[model samples]
Target: MGWSTKQIPSLRGRRALVTGANSGLGLQTALELARAGAHVTLACRDAGRADGAVATIRDQVPDADLEVRALDLASLASVRALAEALDGEGAPLDLLINNAGVMATPERRTADGFEQQLGTNHLGHFALTGLLLERLKAAPAPRVVTVSSGLHRIGRIDLDDLNWERRGYKRWGAYGQSKLANLLFARELQRRADAGDLALRSAAAHPGYSATHLQTAGPGQGGGVGDRLNALVGRVGNVLLATSDAYGAQPTLYAATHPEVSGGAYVGPTRLGQNRGPIGEVPSTRAGHDREVARRLWERSEQLTGVAFGLPAAEPVAG
Candidate 1:
């Protein structure tokens, strides 16, 4: 439980749902979880990509119990549909991994007309988690592991412009905001669950400086000089500073299955600056645990996504 992937207990008989499991970190997370004996649902946007991911994992784990499903986090309709379908399966979902996200993309809106990063990264997963709460609660020691980022330290939440409608978008800034929301939601969920005495826990993790395709996944998807430049720079940085996606996944896996990790806890690389190393509980931004901000953000998310989590109101706490 201190800092090793080998510490992950057997996940047999567990059902895990991993969003954006088509490629990169999400795929790596799913592959490992499947190898660990959990039945994994690969919730991805593209069917072809999902199929490929499943094949790749099966090649390794041969009989890996896996299912491919469609999910586009940008659309609330898709989130609801996926949740409903999974709920209909009549099995407890032991783990909900909200790992899908876009990063450093050009300005664009989602199907819901919100900024792309915030829409997919925060709101989409927010709504999905809420919709699936029932299935999660049916399982023993059910957990929610939302992937956040170290960049959240520099992020600011402008609740008024959560989607940057009034203010113009800065891609990294917007990405930061969404990442901040990930941590806030994770911690707030844990707080609410504890207050209600529910047997559920939520935690967040970050794959610090992982060399995944994520850094370049979004920039050029919009087709612009700046977008291309961002992608190039990101790729360069990945080559120079990022760790392997396999290693990148340890913190996430640790948080998801490690028995010692408590609700509201954060797991990250244990080295200096928490950039890349062993997985362990690391210090996160104080703002991530800001009570007033978390409470307001939770309410606003409920209003925006229209997925009400019938938990008690969050109580204020000093940071």
Candidate 2:
């Protein structure tokens, strides 16, 4: 039988940090981990929303050990602050889930002046992982799970125009690029870990087409024509072809705790188009598997975010 959340072994004494835990897949993932006996930190931008999410989790799992911290993924300063706060706490992080992201939003600049989606989805998590690497490494069998998306297949990493400043941005394209970046970062981190002989394990997961606030939370949060259209599509998408948020979070939970998982593995739903079903290993895009591309993206990410990998460099290859 396939493993579900119930099958997950007790995570007592484990410490977990989940980004974007205020809603959607992040919130659900954090709650499930908490239920499994892990002390979870809900890293979110809004303190009020995070408190509410914690309350909801506590309502169901009265003993849920939860902490809410302010983290704006679109801002580098916020990322740094969050990292510093965690480091100051001096707690070992067993699992770090990079679950926060933006999808299909209008062109906007982040606090760091990068394109909004890329900034929040990729750079923010990139820096967070770097900043928290020490605590993660301190934990026994430390794992870093990054939540990507199926749209990664359609993504192309534009090295020159990473921020979409020169080229006009399309909502889906930007979102796809960020998701692809997530996978690439995971792969590259795995490579670095292996090359440096580090104990940390890095893997990636995709929720597939789960009914989440991602669509509406993007441009739709403001209430406009695009928002209305996105909301309509979201409703139709959920009805016609999408999984529940609970099901969507399966891959992430699996990636974080599955004993059989290895570094660089990608997990998602097992079903038509990977939209729904039990969590299982899935094939990644050729781009996602390209070691050279992964390395280059890693370097660029480090440079853009000003966060070093803190691991030995991988063997350079001809591009």
Candidate 3:
């Protein structure tokens, strides 16, 4: 009785690009979209793994239309490269799923000198979406679905030190900040689209504790006994407490293809602290809806990434 992949309408002729589509949630999202008749480009950091994912999806959907493209989100040059490649093709992009991200990890910085979590999870997607604005606008109805996390509830944006330059970094807090930035970015993007009278829909979704490598990838980086133990715990939690990645991808799929979903909508599971259950629109933190903060973050994102959305600014409030 609940909404599932069965509810996904035919996606024939639509062109989709899913970041981090080599495995887990992104892979599932790509597979389902391909099954629904979309031509999907699996944008990933590892070409081999992406090929493996493509083979796996082909095993299930023999006629699935898919391609692999290299994308390393931590580097702005890589982001620009992928965008430029797509732009040169002069094809309309119907769906852009900003699903690839990093979690809590030992302190690391991206090639752009940004903290790893924020850079990969937030800034990378920011630049990619902005760069792809024209292609998305070309579509009859373009949708941008960004994947955030429930952990975003605990996040606070430190506009003064987004890259961990001014203070000590707690990995989890840094991850939270990045995820919060995702929500704000999605909503702010929608606001700008509406202000500019563009037919672009920007929405955000959370997977709600999906069993994926995301949990272990960060901790495993340290390669120490404690890190190994943490990875083990993450695996254990995945088995015991998390939903399958297929189930987890529903919120994103819903946001991406569902006609009823609107700009600025946030989707997630509807039960158990939003960790697992049927998909539905969900509430976000009050900060998630703060217009001024979203505006400031938008401007800051442009400055940091050197990528601009080129949309009109939010209108002055009628006070």
Candidate 4:
């Protein structure tokens, strides 16, 4: 049988941190993890929404061991602050789900001066993961699940114009690049863990087409007419064809909990185009498997975020 959330083993005593947990796939992922007996921290950018998410989960789980913390992925400072706070807790974090990200939006730079989509979706998680490596290492069989999207196949990582300084920033293309980076990071992290003989495992998952706030929030304000129209089309598509957030979250939950899932595994829905269905170990993109690109991206990410891999820096060619 295919993997399902119902098949998740007891996560008692495990500590998990899920970014973007205030809504959508992240919220559902956190809620299900809590139901499975894991203590989950919902790392979000807004406090009020986080609190609301907490209340929603408590209404169901009632005894859910949960915490809400501030995490603005667009700001490296905020990412570092979250890492520092977790370090202060001095507890092992068994799961680090880099589930926060932004979709298509108007051209904008992050607080750190990088393009918004790439900055929040990829760079921020890269830094946070590096900063929390030690805490994850302290746990038994630690796993990091990076959420990506199917649009990654069209992404081209313009090393020269990574921030879109030269390329005039096509919204969808930029979003694609960000999603591609997520997979590359997950793959490279797994290779690095193996090179260092660490017990930590890293994998990637895609939620498929799901209806969530990311659909509306991306084009609510500041985004141009093109983005707004895009959002309108997205809303219609989601209403007609997209799966629910709970169903969309299954791939991530499967990747996080399934023991049979190996490092560098790419999990997604097992239907047409891997859009929506039960979770399955899917094939990664050609770029996602490129060792050369992953290496350069890793180095560049370290320079951009100033957070190095916590393990003995081993440069391994990911196959």
C-alpha lDDT values of all predictions: 0.90, 0.90, 0.95, 0.91
Candidate 2 least-lDDT 10 residues = 214-223
Error of 4 at 56 (Å): 0.8
Q: Could you tell me how far off, in angstroms, the CA of residue 290 lies in candidate 2 after the best superposition?
A: 1.3
Q: What's the residue-level lDDT of 225 in candidate 2?
A: 80
After superposition, candidate 4 runs with Cα above 4 Å error: 310-319
Pick out the ten consecutive residues of candidate 1 with the lowest summed lDDT: 1-10
How well is each residue in 222-258 modelled by candidate 1, as lDDT tens digits? 7778878878988998899889888888888989988
Query: What is the C-alpha lDDT profile of model 4 across 198-300, one tens digit per residue?
Result: 8998999998888887887776546567667777887888899899999899999999999889889999998888986568889867987887788888889
State the lDDT of candidate 3 residue by residue for 116-218, as single tens digits: 9999999999999999999999999999999999999989999999999888988889999999999999999999999999999999999999999998998
Best by lDDT: 3
Those runs of model 2 whose alpha carbons end farther than 4 Å from true positions after fitting are: 219-227, 316-319
| Candidate 2 lDDT tens digits, 1-319 | 7779988889999999999999889989999999999999999988999999999999999999999888999999999999998899899999999999988888899988999999999999999999999898889889999999999998889988999988988888999999999999998899899898988889999998888878566746546887788878877887777778888899999999999998998999877888766689999889888887778888899999999967976787666
TM-score of 2: 0.96
Candidate 3 clash pair list? none
RMSD, every candidate, angstroms: 1.5, 1.6, 1.0, 1.6
Q: Pick the candidate with the highest TM-score.
A: 3
**lDDT accuracy of residue 36 in candidate 2:** 94
